[model samples]
Target: MEGDCLSCMKYLMFIFNFFIFLGGSFLLGVGVWVLLDPLGFREIVAANPLLFTGVYVVLASGGVLFLLGFLGCCGAIRENRLLLLSFFMLILFIFLAELAAAILAFLFREHLTREYFSRELKRHYQGHNSSDVFTSTWNAVMTTFDCCGVNGPEDFEDSLFRLLSPRTMVPEACCQSNGFPGDVSVEQCVSGSATFRRNKGCYSATVDYFETLLFSAGALLIVVLTIEIFAMVFAMCLFRGIQ
Candidate 1:
């Protein structure tokens, strides 16, 4: 009975680690795709320091998961105490790191307010004509989301964009039209026309976008963490049962 239970535990460990291996491969593929995408993804990520850092984090996480999965599989199959212990230690370290990160995020949540982002936008945002990365990124964001400044057109009142281009109330990306081309004249957009200017702010649109992304990522994270816990438990059990 004891031998049968040990065999069962060993197989369970293998199955769980195999799943983790597949998940890690998927994450690694995604990270590589984003990094090497021929489209505008690389450019967009490069434009933002935070986004660039996130890409690297994704890559590192994928690599670590891949390594952990391999270690778990090998340790279980060979019933190697050293490998099992290493796997447990690594998982514990990652679990503790995640906890620390979560605590820090919660502590700093209040600082990530709209007012803070608005101030940053006002300080660094150049006009539409500027070819800088920040300007281009904002143009792309505004165009993609069909929204204007952080809090709408009013936010640009004292912006550098307004100071630089006094005649233009908002970027051309903020304009909306009913025509085929859908490109309303900038004059109409700036003439206080309600239909021409998009009333929605980029802040809310960005929040919604990130919320959707985070929901998906959070689900995946929970699954991965659960698998890790199971892997750790099975690894320790098998390690102890081994002769």
Candidate 2:
């Protein structure tokens, strides 16, 4: 009975190490392809402008933490304090980062509104069965935000308008080509252009925030994932040494 129990324990440990390493690897691949890829960024932002831009940071960060937790769990099972502690430390750090961000958002009352972004999604459609796409688009937006940083709903609305607004398409000369008629002060031209530019500015801010948030998420994922991989390797070494 004692011999059988020991063998069972050994196998369980091996399984833990093996499975976590696999999970870690899977997470790393996702972090790279889905969250960090530049092309992926454009698709996500264009589809669900509001949802993806805000919380994308957390998705990628937590994913890395999940990988770390797996490593630690496996390391503990193998009785490797060094490897186990390394993962634990990573979790502790991630927890703190999440906590700080959450507190700040709450304290500042920085709520993200999805209305504007969803509107952009609606516009993307060919007008054939576009309603059903909202939730999916919204979820994608949320996922993007999770992996990146989003300012709020307003920010995305502004960004979309900036990049896609057609105000620039309408040249000022078209409005003024008739000449101010009476006295066309220089202020008129400046003010007229500025008025049109305001609309573009809104979109520019929105798009800029979204892009920045996505890039930041990608950056963090790269670093955290690297650590997660190292933890897995360490766990495997311990598992092998156990034999």
Candidate 3:
């Protein structure tokens, strides 16, 4: 009976680690993709450092999970107490960190809303067609998402616009005439008519994009964390049995 239980625990540990390895690979791939995303979807979290930090955290955690999962598999198969103890400690640390992060995310979510994004974006907008990096990034955002200013096209017409480009109310990308695949200039698009510009703002759209990403990431983490906990439990059981 004792031997049978040990065998079952070993099998459970191996199976759990296999799933952990797969989950870690998925997270690692997503983190790398987010870091290299051409569209710059992470810009939505420009105001909050946590969201940006979360990306690196995901990558690091995935790496740890991958390595530790292998270690766990070996420990279970070989019935090594030291390896099992090490796996338990590492996974415990990760579990605590993830729980803390989740709590903080929940607490601060109210401050990271679309209104906050709009306000931050307002501070960065240099004008309709300025040659600054922020301006270019905003232009890319508008073009990619088919949006206008923060709240609308009129959001561009302000003290900022007066200081930069007095005549232009919106960027060329806001206009439907702006050619995305070609070398069309902002001058040509804005010169036509107001009817060509998109009426919707990018603030909501950008927020929505990041919100979806956050939700998916949170769900995945929950699953991975649950797996980690179960693996730890079974590992401890096996360690005790071996002793």
RMSD of each: 3.2, 14.4, 3.1
- Estimate, for each residue in 193-216, the C-alpha lDDT of model 1 and write its tens digit: 667789899879877766876687
Global Cα lDDT for candidate 3:
0.78
Estimate every model's Cα lDDT from 0 to 1.
0.78, 0.45, 0.78
Tens-digit per-residue lDDT, 1-65, candidate 3: 99999999999999999899888888888888878865766554333577778889889988888
How much lDDT does candidate 1 score? Answer: 0.78
Better of 1 and 2 by lDDT: 1
lDDT of 2 by residue, 165-226 (tens): 42322212212223455434323432344332122222334456566755765565455545
TM-score of 3: 0.85
Clashes of 1: 0
Among all candidates shown, the one with the greatest TM-score: 3
Off by over 4 Å in 1: 33-48, 110-112, 177-184
Q: Which runs in model 3 stand beyond 4 Å of their true positions?
A: 42-48, 128-133, 178-192, 207-214
Assess candidate 1 and give its TM-score to the true structure: 0.83
